[model samples]
Target: MGIVTSLLPFSIRCEPDGDVLCAHLAKGNRQIDELREQPPTSVLFHGPQGYVSPSWYATKREHGRVVPTWNFVVVQVWGTPTIRDDVQWLREQIEELTNAAEKGFRMPWKVADAPEDFIQAQMKGIVGLEIPVSRIEGKRKLSQNQPDRNQAGVIAGLRETGQEALADAVAEGRRQPDDFSLAK
Candidate 1:
């Protein structure tokens, strides 16, 4: 079968064992159907990302050589999937997911807050997936190609626009050495 791309809003979690990733799919979704065939799969995860304007670069004012770009962090994982329909495993996965998502709430909701029968019934409509990671690649593009002043400008621009996460990433990127010849 050919590759079928899907942009699923999955509640993904990396297992403590560090070897696998877990998520779920609605039973009838095409992606779930394809995974049942035991084909190789790839999952992409996006971290902080944002648009960058040339106006934020010091070089743009000193010289007209800068162009708008995007700053982002991403990870891609490849593996063969194991489809699971076991109720117990599904329950555990969902509970962990729920706890993580609701951690910031003053009153966090839980799976047990709902009736057991209703939770069980809802589980029937979804299947769990475990992908034993075979390979992982990551990239962080946080204005590493620019000079120090320009990078500082980007950090300020991102923060002023309410992109604190991306701004932090840019600041962190400044500490990491890169191979870009233009970096200073």
Candidate 2:
């Protein structure tokens, strides 16, 4: 939250009115689903996901059966986004973020350590967008509905497909046992 994106893989900022400034960095081919003319203030950042085995479906007729599925955890925040025009503020904010990200590291990089000219040039090419949260929500779709055995099956299947993240999330969600459960 401070300012470092390195610890966290990526982040994006857009405007309050959904007007401008949104960046997306995921898999090289991951799509950026936002219209340019309309910048959405609801910025969504995701971490990881893996496949959920269909065997996890509680409604399944039998175990070790047909197709599989996927599960994941995601976060979405909506707010008024502002574009920072003050260069000084942007620099300070970026520095703060960097320090926060590197707080636990033994040797953290410092903005001041870089040459002034190089820093200025780098700053010139980049812009900052402010996103103030007005609404925040978390969505974690997992296999809570499945029986313990099926949940294990899903985890196994996810591991097999190399989608361990998704499998792990579904497994965790199942441990909670709640409404909107994905058992079906």
Candidate 3:
């Protein structure tokens, strides 16, 4: 949740562990300084999304009355972020993070692939974050607000734009019950 912004393009990587979220950030990052003063943080995870033009709606052609919208899926995690500067913890965090990200690749890379001294030096530059989860909220704004035919039109438009993933998301949303009251 720590928003690391610097002159250089260094990004903080957040990892999830059970009920807590972790982030690997630079030692002297502005975000770290801000967190020291105020610990609360919120991390947002955004899934596939694309702009939906009125032209993508079947109703627009039938009645000439429709508006633009966007389709997206997002999750927000809220908690207090704690910074830990332990070398072992950072090493493990980096290892797990690397493994998870590389698992689907043809050739996965490991921290051990690099020299120990070099890796040790790299680890020293960052700190680990542990944010105990207080609340987690999620939302999916697909074409659920539209009629079935309009939803299909949106899916077709998304696919035409080479956004198969977004089209798939809309299709998935369409499969859900209209009333999500059962969801906790």
In order, candidate lDDTs are 0.84, 0.57, 0.77
Candidate 3 deviant stretches above 4 angstroms: 1-18, 177-184
Ranking by TM-score: 1, 3, 2
Tell me the alpha-carbon RMSD of every candidate: 4.7, 8.7, 4.5
Question: Candidate 3's residue-wise lDDT over 47-84, tens digit each?
Answer: 79889988988899799989898788876667777777
Ranking by lDDT: 1, 3, 2
Candidate 1: 10-residue stretch with minimal lDDT: 175-184
Regions of candidate 2 where Cα sits further than 4 Å from its true position: 1-40, 55-66, 100-106, 159-167, 175-184
- Give the number of the best model, judged by lDDT: 1
Instruction: Give the per-residue lDDT of model 1 (tens digit) for 1-184.
Output: 4777766544555556557777777887778777888897888888899999999888888988988999998878788899999999899889978888899999999999999999999999999998887777778899988899999999999999999999999999878653222111
Q: Of the pair 1 and 3, which is ahead by TM-score? A: 1
